[model samples]
Target: MDYFDPAGFCKVGDEAGFRNLRAAELKHGRVAMMAALGASVQHYVQFPGFDEVPTGIGAVTTAPGSYGFAALFLVSGVLELALWTEDPKKEPGNFGDPLNLGQYDIDMRNKELNNGRFAMFSIVGIIAAELFTGKDGIDQIGLDTPTL
Candidate 1:
């Protein structure tokens, strides 16, 4: 799509403008999605033998960590909101409901957990591969003996 170049209105190193500018906004979101996906994929590899847990219950090995992280995230997020975000609790508008804080924290925490799922997968894949290759034993490691 051909469009007007807004470089005339954009200044170098203007991050806010760079992020908000029309052209930049579209590209920024795409790049952000790609980077986040890559990071999430890497995160999945952090858990070793997580899938070894049984068919039904094995999957939960990571759940507790995810849950713990989520809880911490919620608690910290609320504090951050109180510090950085507008104190809706003190505001007079209808948008400022203190009770909404808990819900918002939960919602935000869930999102974080969901986004980290990809990383969890990637990590598991790598660890499983390693174990399957006999790396799980200390006596034997890499198969780089030049043997066919």
Candidate 2:
């Protein structure tokens, strides 16, 4: 997985240079997969109660913001990962017509980027709503702390 360490890569200056290079690429991919797995696990761990969806709109706004945040992360991650491609020709069948190439067409790329922006904005709004109902200034509009 040594992308920068010159000495870490397989012997690539000899007759088997191509093989060594391929081997190095495979190693790098393995390292990447392991890193992504760790990150994904961490992301899931942050949301302890994902299965419990609130019954209504008020319940949704008050029942731990982590629920919505986690859902957004999971959904967007799936969409982005599905669109990932280092080689356009080898993209999966579900990605759409291969004729409209460029690894990912502008429309697909925009969708991925916009999903991320939407998630960020949604999280910010969630936090702002939480803050508004916190013990400081502001009205008691949020259900996070109902007087009853």
Candidate 3:
């Protein structure tokens, strides 16, 4: 499957398509978007057979693969309010089913917030500390040394 491209993420951030989306969808916009994205990942995790795995990526097995999952629960919490907030054309009730949260608007607002590019990156900062504490001298002991 194709992953999201940051380069083209702006394509969805148009005036007409996402005009005042923050004001309209508010917090629900991000939540709705995340629900959709999360569902996609879940699909990949559940049905990662030959047809599901992408071409040239080799097979999808437990052979040491790394994937990242991070989203701004901040924006999602905001969006939950957005969906039911005042709208001239809409009512102040569940715009969607309580069971269905809908999909992401796929704009820069969500992408930037979800990615480490924006928001408080304290986790990244803390994890970077490991750079100075590498696995030093551990590999030099050709095999197990004798007990003292």
lDDT digits (tens) for residues 1-148 of candidate 3: 1134355533554633333433343344444444434332432343333244321122223232212111344454576566445444642222444655454334533563454232223323322332344211221222323312
Q: Estimate each model's TM-score.
A: 0.22, 0.24, 0.20
Give the per-residue lDDT digits (tens) of candidate 1, residues 67-122: 54567568867864675343224311112346765553445534543444454554
How does model 1 score by TM-score?
0.22
- Per-residue lDDT over 46-107 for candidate 2, one digit per residue giving the tens place of the 0 to 100 score: 34454353322233355565456568668857855675333334322123566865656556
lDDT value, residue 26 of candidate 2: 40
Supply candidate 3's per-residue lDDT for 29.
41
Worst 10-residue lDDT window for candidate 1 reads 51-60
**Range of the 10 consecutive residues with the lowest summed lDDT in candidate 3:** 135-144
**Between candidates 1 and 2, which one is better according to lDDT?**
2
Best by lDDT: 2
